[model samples]
Target: MNLNLRHAIIQNVASNTKEELEDTIIDAIRSQEEKMLPGLGVLFEVIWQNANEDEKEEMLSNLKDGLQKQ
Candidate 1:
């Protein structure tokens, strides 16, 4: 069966408030499960698409810092 995973994920969380979204993201990260990566990627995609240039720069910087910790 063909499934639109990205669309399905977006639809599933579309009605969530900011706090709920934050909790979902935090939980997904803390779970440390490979299955959650796609959901986090989707959330990052949404954030990137809506972010301004400065915000994007900040995100990139934060990502770089995060990677450096490993």
Candidate 2:
């Protein structure tokens, strides 16, 4: 992460009201994920290493169920 971006996040989140704080945390988590995904083959490799066969299938099933509700 860039130093300026870190500083910006700290400043904004620190100043957040109760309602804004949830959004601030969600945005920070999303930003970190955006920086890691697709190109980060190591992330998939880790997922594969840790997730068992049944766990993967269950995750896929839950994803499909959630999407259908939407």
Candidate 3:
């Protein structure tokens, strides 16, 4: 079977409002389910692609801090 997971995920949430998107992200993180990782990754990819250099740096710093907490 052929599947475009990223495209599918993007399409699934394309119409969501900001609040709905926030809820989805929070739910996915709280669930901590393996199946949700790809969705989160796709979301992050979207964010990364759209972010400015300063925003990207902030994200990288946040990620670094998060990893250090582990």
Candidate 4:
């Protein structure tokens, strides 16, 4: 994402309620058709997979037991 895109995402998500965030995410996914799904999954999976390595061991540990605080 570019600077504007990053700022927009942060502002949008930070200012919204949980329901609104969920709705926005769903809408964004819908707007992208199926193509963006793979990209999104790839993003998550990259973090999930790489975090297992020594470099991210600490983060990986937290992720497993971390509270899903909204």
Candidate 5:
């Protein structure tokens, strides 16, 4: 069986509205469950893929700050 988690995750949320997507992200973060990590990673992958250079730089900067705080 070939199970592509990233593809599955993306397909699952493909029809989500902006607010639904926001809720999904927020809920996943607040859940703190290991299983949710893959879904979050998939979402981040989509965001990173579509982000412009400036957005990517901002994301990296935010990521750096987040790591520092942790």
Candidate 6:
């Protein structure tokens, strides 16, 4: 088993449109299943990698707020 999960995840979503991607993310979150975490993590990694400083700061702020609510 030589699976590259990150690459696999990326590949799986590579052809999705914005709406489709949004649906996938939303469904994954709503499902509340542990298996979806890795896919969400990979999506977050992609978002973080592509985001600018301000976006990153916003994401961090949102994350902090989300954590506080938990």
Tell me the TM-score of each prediction against the true structure.
0.91, 0.35, 0.93, 0.40, 0.92, 0.92
Expressed as tens digits, the lDDT of each residue in 1-70 for candidate 5 is 1249878999999999999999999999999998999899889989999999999999999999999999
User: What does the lDDT come to for candidate 6?
Assistant: 0.94
Against the reference, the lDDT scores of all candidates come to: 0.92, 0.60, 0.93, 0.60, 0.93, 0.94
Which one wins on TM-score?
3
- Clash-forming residue pairs, model 3: none
| lDDT measured at residue 47 in model 6 versus the true structure, 0 to 100 | 99
Candidate 1 residues 1-70, lDDT tens each?
Answer: 1248988889999999999999999999899999999888888999999999999999999999999999
lDDT top scorer = 6
lDDT per residue, candidate 3, 1-70, as tens digits? 1259888999999999999999999999999999999998998989999999999999999999999999
| Candidate 2: tens digits of C-alpha lDDT, residues 1-70 | 4557555545545665867865644565578876534323333344567899998898789879999999
Q: Report the lDDT tens digits of candidate 6 across residue range 1-70.
A: 1259889999999999999999999999999999999999999999999999999999999999999999
Candidate 4, poorest ten consecutive residues by summed lDDT: 38-47
Better of 1 and 3 by TM-score: 3
The 10-residue segment of model 3 with minimum total lDDT is 1-10
Model 1: residues >4 Å from true position, as ranges?
Answer: 1-3
